[model samples]
Target chain A: MTYEVYVNVLPLKGLLDPQGKTVHQGLNKIGLSQVADVRVGKRIVMHIDANSEEEAKSIAEDACKKVLVNPVMEGYEIEVAQNA
Target chain B: MTYEVYVNVLPLKGLLDPQGKTVHQGLNKIGLSQVADVRVGKRIVMHIDANSEEEAKSIAEDACKKVLVNPVMEGYEIEVAQNA
Candidate 1:
């Protein structure tokens, strides 16, 4: 079966996100002063071939831990579903 | 009320994503050969002050269009919910 995995990798809380800050400034410049805060992260979508949903999730988690995520600064969440 | 808006900005289909390609190569190098394809995008979370959910979503969409997204090569989706 083929599973679609969505991995959201976000910076750790309390960390400084320069990119997000720049975006916030940009928004303010564009007159979006009502936007209180902005934080930016990465969303990675992968198509994986696996025996089951659990297997796909496990694979995605492993991939995230091994390569996609930087534990020093980022955390990741994985969601897996069978592709229709 | 305060609203939390999630904006997902993705590369338009058919555009080359060098970042995703690099991640895909890295995954394959680490022996996760089952991953068929990988696409990487951005997730921007914003806190906005708005009177209603529709207003919050509209604000987020405007921000995406004005600053966060490059419409020439990207597309975006916005989701909004009231903050607790």
Candidate 2:
């Protein structure tokens, strides 16, 4: 079986996001200008294997806690795509 | 009203993702290990205002093209969350 996951990546609270800030500045330069506090993060897609939905979820959750995310700073959500 | 958007973040095709690779290695160390070629990316959330769905989408698409994404290297998809 196949499982697909969606993840949210963000900087640690109080950590500087110069890249995000730079993009915010660029937004103004382009006249999309009104946007403020633009923060940029990453999204990842993964395909995993399991025999049942519950099994897939368990596996994915463990993966996130163990390797996919750093719980102290980053946050994530995993959806076992029904289509998968 | 309110509009919510979901974004997918990824590295340029040829760019190296050392962070992702590191995580992949860590996964192996942890026995969640079957995963290989793990590539990391980001997901972002945004709230926008518009009178109608079409208008909100147009504004968001323009924003993506103009500033939120660098079409040459990055890719994104905007979903207007009905729950918004």
Candidate 3:
């Protein structure tokens, strides 16, 4: 079965997100002062070939942990579902 | 009320994502060949100060369209929920 695995990679809590801060300052300079903060993260959508939903999730989790995320500075969450 | 707005920004179909292409090539070089494709996107988390959910969603949608997404090459979806 083919499953869709969505991974959200976020900077670890309490980490300084330079990208987010840059955007935040840009927003304020452009008159969007109402936007307090901007937290940017990657939303990766992967199509996995697996025998079951469980297998797909694990594959995605493993890939994310091993390659996609930087464990020292980032954290990730994976959500899996059968593709329509 | 404060609401948490989640935005998923995806490259429009038929548009070339240089970042995804580079990552794909790197993955193939490193021997993660079972992975068919990698589509990169942004999942933005925003705290919206609004009186209702509708307002927060609209704020998020407006920000996404105006500043976050490139309308010619990208599309976005926003989901809103109240902060606990």
Q: Name the candidate that leads on DockQ.
A: 1
Candidate 3: how many backbone clashes?
0
Give the Å error, residue B3, model 2: 2.0
Tens digits of per-residue lDDT for model 2 on B1-84?
766655566767687778777876777788874353456775655555667777667766887887677777676677777635
Give per-residue lDDT, candidate 1, residue A73: 98
True contacts kept of each: 0.89, 0.42, 0.55
Candidate 2 per-residue lDDT, tens place, A1-84, comes to 666655566665576767767876776688764343555676655556667777767877888777666777666666667634
lDDT by residue for model 3 over A1-84, one digit each (tens)?
A: 677778888888799988878767776677666667678899887777787888878878777766788999988999887672
Model 3, span B1-84: residue lDDT tens: 777778889888688988777766666667666556678888887777777888777777778766899999888899886672
Candidate 3: where is the Cα deviation over 4 Å?
B28-31
List of clashing residue pairs for candidate 3: none
Q: What's the best-to-worst order under lDDT?
A: 1, 3, 2
What TM-scores do the predictions have? 0.96, 0.74, 0.90
| DockQ (CA atoms), all models | 0.90, 0.44, 0.63
DockQ of 2: 0.44
lDDT of each: 0.90, 0.66, 0.78
Cα error, residue A48 of model 1, in Å, equals 0.8
